[model samples]
Target: MTEDARWLSGLEEQARARLAAPVFEYVAQGARDGQTASRAVDTWAAVEFHPHVLRDVTDVGLETELLGSPVGVPWGVAPSTLQRAIHPDGELAMARATAQAGGVMVVSSNAGTPFSLIGETGVRWWLQAYLPADRTLAVPMLDRAVAAGASAVVLTVDTPVVGTKYPVGRVVWDVVDPALLRVNFDKGTDERPGADKALDLGPHDVDWLAEHTGLPVVVKGVLRPDDAVRCVQAGARAVWVSNHGGRQLDRAVSTAAVLREVIAAVGEQAQVYVDGGVRSGLDVVAALSLGADAVFLGRLPLYALTDGEPGVARMHREVGAQVVETMRLSGCRTLADVAALHAPSAPNHP
Candidate 1:
């Protein structure tokens, strides 16, 4: 195996060994038969690069901006719940690592760490939320996140209801102390009817979030080009192509498969980001080439968090270095160069 593959495999082994079986499976397994989850990474790998040769390769730049703020890299952490279940330090450790690495961390609404603590770590972060059936139930959380300095609000538009995983077995929530997952919400507020995830999330909810938070609304879990356009029309500042890391929908299309189409539809209207199955720096390049402004890492960072703060720091360093090396080898210096290399061409005349 390649060095990168070996390193990732080793990390996964360590995570599996350290975490309880249910916790590990909760992070590792996808819905149903795991077909979409398994295919997500392979789809990225299937994209072949036609590298340029004999160009300057001395310095490769990896800097970029997400939603107007500069980030040291074009990739960041995707929001995931129950991080404390993975390690004692949880999201706090992740915030420290991401801050040190100069990347963003999108905090889950169900985050174990308090938003204020995460903010104190100095990471450029965004808040990810699922609008409850009663939208007002989200107001306090949104107010809290903004007060804690969240730069954006990522609305996860999938999961009208949580998808069913096969085997119907006890998962991480069943085995862990439920308190670890309830730290973000007020006492018993989470169990209230207003706290249930909304079933009818539509484009207007995008405008509502933006108005309520006064923060850029990033519509996540979008896979269709038309849906992307609708989100932009409804005032979404960005549309994230994702499949909930293949956890919410068993056989949904991989983000890699539809990134270009989504970008094509709304590239001019808003920034485009993607997550799900992005495990390598090469995968980052492929997504950027297909017009994605940024790529987000989902399960990879969580697995690294198994080793705590330093493990996540190392993951950022390694992946960032890999991106630089790939860009240098491909005769590209900047993110724009990478995008230009894969720019769409005009049709030929007969």
Candidate 2:
């Protein structure tokens, strides 16, 4: 078998075995029956691609910019908690792979290695944060991310509370190692102190982050149209429509369904992105066709890491390869073409 195909399927089984029961479950399970989780894939599957007949296939480029920074491709690695559990390299492995593949990597607020420790190079870094109730704790983390050289900040708004994911006769949370799950650090250090300011994001908190950090601010986990509008008015440079992978709320709309509404709210003033159940190149196509500037992969990268750092690298390479092939076969020549191509959604739900 070709290296990509061999490694692709092999990682699933290896990941299933390497991860401790609890670690695997927490990463694998979705909320409730995990219907939303399953729906993530189904929704993408329902979007058909209409390939153009006469486009020149040679020299297609998948490059694009997220919040003004160049990225090799529109696809990226989403932030999840604790990288070390899956591999000794943890986020560093993923970070390196991101650089190697020429994609973006959004590091978690709770990253095991402080963002400063992970080098910024060929890959662009975006900071992913939870608006913690305690500003003292939150501010410093943001400060650290800034010091780490992050180009943008992604504020995850759906995690008012953590998620519960039960998958196929298993309560996934019960199996993951609790230690690895908490990637954020203990408070009382000298990073900064404005996390409490984010408890109920208003113009004050939002403006401070943008004005103080000088980083492009994007709000994540926003599913409502009004919320999207609020984020933009509050100075959001972009909006990332996510249900936290259906890991936080079971009833949230599929990421694909909400893309247009968020885009409409921002209406060219800001860019829009999506996460959750974005598993393949076709899935990437689905989100972009609907108007997402980009999409993030939270679970898939972690799943690959289960076999160690090399596994994660393998995953990014193969996935990047898949996305390139998908782009070529779809008859799109660039990220803009992917944005320009449109196909009607399937008549019925899968």
Candidate 3:
């Protein structure tokens, strides 16, 4: 297929056909009513870019640093759970692709394979943590990630308790391969209580993590400006604004709307990242313009997983090309230029 055909929408279509019905819905659908998830994509349409003309638009640089780490693209993969359900190669395939593209891969705590294997790809990756109530269980994983060469720690704070996902709830686990969900957990008495119960983790936990790890701690899933500020104040190296891809709560505010407010709150103190409904490079430009340091993709990466590494690579290239072209047309030759394109009067939604 042409590069144009491999954009997120097309790949999503391909994935829907390739993945099992339950698997597809788990990856694609959001919580009850699904409005939050839908808004994540639809609201961006209301953000109109006022392109400047006659600028030196020949070379648009998409390279930028996130958390002081150099990345070729301005965006990266957001954490996804149980990826082996989507594809056999799972996170490992996606890691290889991210490494090839010089993009970041935020490997989920829920990844099917061990982090060590994924780390072997040498991709610039961040380990995403779903903190459990038990510090004993969570700390070793963080320490293991450090030993495995993880660049940063992404602590997912939104999911204090697992939100209701109807489709995923109906999944027939009997058919899924046991090896697919084999995360690096102790097989015997080492139980993973965080996987099921509410973590009850809070801002103090963020501070503790900062003190514990040499790796920068990125607090993901903050929507409110107050919470974002609190995370920064608690020593979060970065705050990732997300809605758990609309998986946690329905009727939640779209990431597109909350991002600007969150950035205004703690933009200077910490790097602010966002995810949810990010489908194209133009969307990435819009996010940067609105004040996000970088954007993340949740569904797109999982969808790309159906076709394995090549598919993921093509998605990156397509989005990167979109970023370049959008920059060229909008008179932005760099990320700073895109940031300057923010218009205070831009409509929040249709």
* TM-score of every candidate: 0.95, 0.87, 0.93
Choose the strongest candidate by lDDT.
1
- Whole-model Cα lDDT of every candidate shown, in order: 0.88, 0.75, 0.82
CA lDDT, candidate 3, residue 3: 60
| lDDT tens per residue, model 3, 278-304 | 888878888988888888988988888
Ranking by TM-score: 1, 3, 2
lDDT of 1 by residue, 1-350 (tens): 13464576477788889989889999988998999899998998887776777988887888888898999989999999889999899999999999998899999998888999999999999999988999988888889999999999999999899888874467676788877764666677878887788988998899899888899999999999999999999999999999999998889999988989999899688999999888888888988877799999999999999989998988888788778878888888889888865644465689
lDDT of 2 by residue, 26-142 (tens): 677788777787788788878767666577767778788888877787889888876777777788888887888788899887677757667554357888876655555666667
Comparing candidate 2 with candidate 3, which one achieves the higher TM-score? 3
The reply for model 3, stretches above 4 Å from the true place, is 168-174, 189-199, 344-350
Q: Which of candidates 1 and 3 reaches a greater TM-score? A: 1
Better of 1 and 2 by lDDT: 1
- Supply candidate 3's per-residue lDDT for 176: 71
Report the candidate with higher lDDT, 1 versus 3: 1
Model 3 lDDT, full chain set: 0.82
Question: Model 1 lDDT vs. the true structure?
Answer: 0.88
